[model samples]
Target: MAVPGHKLDRMFNPEVVAVVGDKGPGYMWLRNNLPFKEKGGRLYSVQLDEKEIPGIEALGIQNFKSMADIPEPIDYALVAVPRQVSPYVLKDLIANKANGAGFFTSGFAETGEELGVKLQTQLTEMAREASFNLVGPNCMGLYLPKVGVRFNADAPVADDGKIGFLSQSGTHGIMFSLVSAANGMHVSRCASFGNAVVLDVSDYLEYLMLDDETEVIGMYVEGVKNGRRFFETLREACKRKPVIVWKGGQTEAGARATMSHTGSLAAPQAVWDGMMRQCGAITTNNLDETIDVMKLLLNAKRPTGTGMALLAQTGGQSVSITDAFSKAGLRVPRFSDGTYTELGEFFNIVGGSFQNPLDMAGTIQGSMDTLDRILRILDADPNVDAMAMELSAMFAARQWKGKPETLDKTIEEIALHKERSKKPFLVILHPAHEAEYVASIQPKFHAANIPLFQSFERAAAAFARVLGGGGRARTRTGVVGLALETQPR
Candidate 1:
């Protein structure tokens, strides 16, 4: 009994929400729903406890003795009662015809106990028979920022974001939203569906694939109950938009941990990797890589080929940049004869080299005009599909000590050039032990729609993934470029 898309839609953008069994210890679930209340969604509490009723009401939220007592229908409900008492509350929700519900109670099948397993089975039977949209028996569920629905109180409420995320772990889901938001990326919708007994990963994947608001989809999966269905949905999703997957339990030890964590049976590392590659989907190892890859896909221009042009401020940096990109399966080829001849006209050879990985060590530090000319030359080169520049945080700070306006103007000019150029441009700003200084300047790059990486390795890896996955660019209507013509490998 699969839940219909319209029901899921109403659940996601619930006009009325309720919290069942929220207590005073932390009042966590009730507090988590404050975002919905603040955003003009009607919120009610379904609590029978006499002592906790006043505290909940003190927060100005209307409290009802039961779901039936609520004046209106509930689009979504958060159930946080004790595990033993969950079935009763769920029955009440179903009797009231709530659209969907997410259970915060643990000690379900993941506990591996007879009682826990029986309880989960009972709830699954009930949900399936009634066609209820049960999100999770043990997970934080649904962070829809546009509608101000959140699992964590601190999650951002900005609506203008492009990333859609789905995860099996609540911690990863919450962390992804907060971390991505902090990095100037926002999630259109996020679901941490734990022990997905009723609504599984495939359900959400299908929903997001057609979501107009989501441009890119990110997944953090431990495993799936139906492999064929999940991959079918994933393959179709990749065809529509870029799908980045971070498989959690690739190792034996980690796989064992996942069974208890989400009662998932993770696939072998080789099988998972091969499947993702065959689906034309990008793969990442951890949270950082996932975010980095999404940032590149959303912000950077799509590379027509794998040829990269590297620029560095120091000789050592030039060597490292070339090595990093090359090792990541991208080529740092030589420039065309015409490109080299053009550079020879003004490129200072006394302290710099005019090759593919152009070493501008002592040449363009004093002249922004010279740097601009170099960028133009590279941008015009036929062999260069993409360009990357490496700068030290300390160098930037020292160079623009009192001329902050100059730095701003330079960044603006670079952004403009990127727009005009046919190739994609990336920047690698090394912290160089000046992390705070680097962080302070990142917002400028973000504001200018420039993708900035903290290291050459990260930038190169993310770029390689984007190119290797498919050279496609997502537009408001759909995907564009050769990516659509190519079949999954």
Candidate 2:
């Protein structure tokens, strides 16, 4: 049993930090942007010769010549200087007994250089001896809202507190933040641990499990720091909060390329699949699906074990959603005779027969109204535990004509009214480009605990997955996009 508590406390709640680097955007970025000036986490800047960056307010202390100059007990260090100079920096941190460090400078083993690999090995040895945890020699560290922790112009976690995202690419970490923000997914923290030297994915997983702020966890992986330990952490976290992994650089070809870059060993797909299932982790097909499930798990009710409901305004959508439920291995239970009769009473408008995929348009006119009826019907059905709504805003110029165009606001209201239900509720809006307006609905979904997705198929699949005992909890959801995030203009 790896104890992650002591390591996590030193990282997130660090009281003093030493950032070593040349005059570059990375170091200056932190100085100008860190929100911790008020958190009392003292920051010390280190450079070989240069001093006095242009915009920083004078802290009155001269730029430290070395780690020894800083008399304070440094909790964390960021080695962002040139790669050639990194080993020395790591040595300094170790000598000072720094709690941990996020080594953002690349060009080590990842560069495929013999000397670079040697550098990483030596630094790892030094770190182990010093008893300090390390995140990356070529990565971004972690994000924690509770302690005012973040990187310079990095980590775009929304202000809401719903999930935590961890990735191996700092780029993915930053992009996930922005996409999560655009989609309205609030997060407790997001970390991009590149080239893990000491602390790796498993370490973060253990920490997030104990983190009261996170309800779910999302990961984008180029490599796992330790596979066995990772599975151990995943097993425990899945029992608590849902864990979703997007195994990037996943193919054999891509994995081979990874070894040269970071000496990483990508696992086989079959092995990965069985591992995820045993630990109860939801493995995604791609980056898109990964983010889709992450946001939705934040909204799903609970891992209910087998049925679903499909609600759409049009028969075509109903047909597609029904097919999706079937393919996902979930049953769309036909409405009970009594339930059918009650819905039939309103058949004057909804002429279609009331079935599992109820095209309830007669009495339900708007997105809000349609969803309301669907919710009532599904809630009453013990067999139907989850639902998928195919929504194409009538106002969306490309799809429908009657859309209130105000569907975002209307959807917001419905969620607010149904805030208490834990059943998996999802709406898949057809692809469109009115980004700003469509994206506006995100905050409300997060607020109401219902998840909104851009792909109808993903929305349906997520519902089936959770209800079929293949996914985690229910009701509210979100999407952290990588490419084609269904951005609202």
Candidate 3:
């Protein structure tokens, strides 16, 4: 599907790309790092410097003396030239009929200088006249792995991914892309539309809605070009797919920083909250929470109701999980007599509580035999809409340090239960051991499509978010539908 206001093909899947101002070491490093040359997209180094530019020829990039001298159609240009000469370089690019341009050079509106602002305006105006999009005057630019385009050298390039990310800050965009990859959420496209002179957040959201590859969108927005249009677009996108927003510039000091950083007028926190609530979009304050929310959407089943049945190894953790769920407006209801009778067969009353937020100290510590039965029972229970289990894999690893086989068996059981369970199941893995231990088990859990978190609070919060702001327990009527509008506060 064709995206509006931006020919994303040229913006991302360009046939031929030119990197202007390739004289310096920075551009050389970037050119060396671009992995797309071997992956179908042809790359060219446009350098006016006839002098010997070190390390240019070795990369096998087609070098050109000028934009017009390239002698081929230029789909997109990454202009890294100085602010003073950017206009002239852009003019040359337009003359060559380049479809889109991403200005990696800063010193535009962000500099708070009239000349910089004027130059930025001129560039966008020229792009508009040319009937293509201007991505940024101060950004890292696109990272669409499907077509072999990326801004950072080390960013992961997946054949296909589901996340569609758009960020106002270039650094934040890189962070989200990398972090999402680490958490097993692959990104389809990431655009850092710095200063957003031409293509803003609203346009990107619309494009993501139409893109078949994107199932979820994670946005890092500081400001918007049009508030009403953005809100309406956000509402529409939410109806189609999950839209996770991380609005920076919430504090007074942060607002000042955002203005200087992206030349954006950060809206008030109250207004931002209202928009998110009205649009049925999830709010993530930081990158970790963003990943947390995305992980829930990608891995877990959409909840039919807010009734949660938490099973924890430790009594303290059980209490904490219940508190967190309560604070988030989710319910931790009592188990039915039938469930209690069945649970009694495996759980000896000596060490655990069978009530809601079931403390499975004895069962967790002793028996792996009852694990599947426990999961199946919880899933079948009419009172339990969702389930959360705290598994201390790190502690278990420590106890069975030499027995990697035992650990694997335990994880395998959890994975098997996750596949068979009808209700949404959340596994909270407490990283109580060294980084290596946690790392070893994370991939296994991720492989099983089980949502894993380091703490109960985070897990509970994710469950609550899935429950649409969780309140009193609601019965599982059917598959939970997406929240179409914000419930009044």
Candidate 4:
């Protein structure tokens, strides 16, 4: 999907950005770590220091003593000034007609103090009065790679992709986005709206629904001001695109953490679950599930049913995978008689069972050609809705091929069959400590858009998530833009 030309221009593609106050480590990191200097926009250091800010002048970053001193109009104002003077800097930004402001300074309502609350309320009123979109009073605002808008220098710089994420926690936002990018789901945009004194979770959720670049929206939400509005927006969004939500706080202790972390009042787990079910939104418990879901949702083809075909390198592993699939609410139907007969023609079926979770140890040991043929048959089988290959190469003594060319050919064959099948194909590389070895060959699977997991249980769990979400309602054929009228200024 293509990004909306207008919204992209205004929100993300800020041609001129002003950073106010002492350029601390965060500000310096953002300035120093910008991925592209000659691309979309320019960043300026706004501070009292008249002396040149080091290393910025060469990278298209200009220095201005104040926002007023800068003659050119600023698209966005990043407030990192001292707490007492932040209000004044914001006033100057408004006077200069800046379209948006992202306050990275803390000491807002999160402190749970009357003064903090008053300060946050004051900032919110200022934004409303000036008709400018406020990101947060105490948060890392935007991390958009397309326009070089990033808050953390250490975060991954991924080429813009389909996933769009929002979080109420700054650290979680950075962590999840980086994790998602490394796992092949490149995030188009990510916002950490801490305290949410101005634009809340609902606003971002609604915005992402219209973002043309966003095919899937993932959120790490602590709380919301208006539950009904949040759920309503979520339900409408789910109808158009997939919305994956991870509610942060469920227990009393966790609720306290949410309150302290973002000054949010987290709802009960039961209430949150009911709301998610009613809205048809996918739910996640922790960060691992969040990443797992995104990896599969972005890459795997949507399935119409839950009939899974499991193939493992060993019989015991196959049994474990079959059990996991069954527990995950997926069907492991017995292959039709024709399928059994077809398989018998390919291999000596003396010891191998022809049912679901077919053990391919003998076929793999015998010939890569036979294993490739079996995969093609399973891929074309109408009874199989999804295919899973659980492998423990460390446990197997058989070598499928001694040369790189032969192995590449085999991988190519498996990839082609998986592609033609138009269903989720999960490859489980087991043994947690042997992940490094698995990682070496993981790219072969990822290159074909197949999901690779560390365990049989995780593979089945991800498949179950895909089935629960119903996947994207429509195939993304073209860019889907959000209506311009409702877009934030």
**Number of the top lDDT candidate:** 1
- Using Cα atoms with residue i matched to residue i, what is each candidate's TM-score against the true structure? 0.94, 0.85, 0.91, 0.89
Model 3 off-target regions past 4 Å?
1-6, 23-29, 52-54, 365-367, 469-489
Off-target runs (Cα >4 Å) in candidate 2 are: 1-5, 22-28, 31-33, 51-62, 152-160, 349-353, 367-374, 395-409, 420-422, 433-436, 467-489
How do these models rank on TM-score, best leading? 1, 3, 4, 2
lDDT of 3 at 270: 78
Clashing pairs in 3: 329-470
C-alpha RMSD of each candidate structure in angstroms = 5.3, 7.2, 5.3, 5.2
Q: After superposition, how far is residue 396 of candidate 3 from its true place, in Å?
A: 0.4
lDDT of 3: 0.78
lDDT score of residue 246 within candidate 3:
91
Task: Give the per-residue lDDT digits (tens) of candidate 4, residues 25-94.
Answer: 3456346335645575666677676444653455557777767888777776677766667778778888
Residue 149 lDDT in model 1? 82
User: How big is the RMSD of model 4?
Assistant: 5.2
Error of 1 at 50 (Å): 1.4
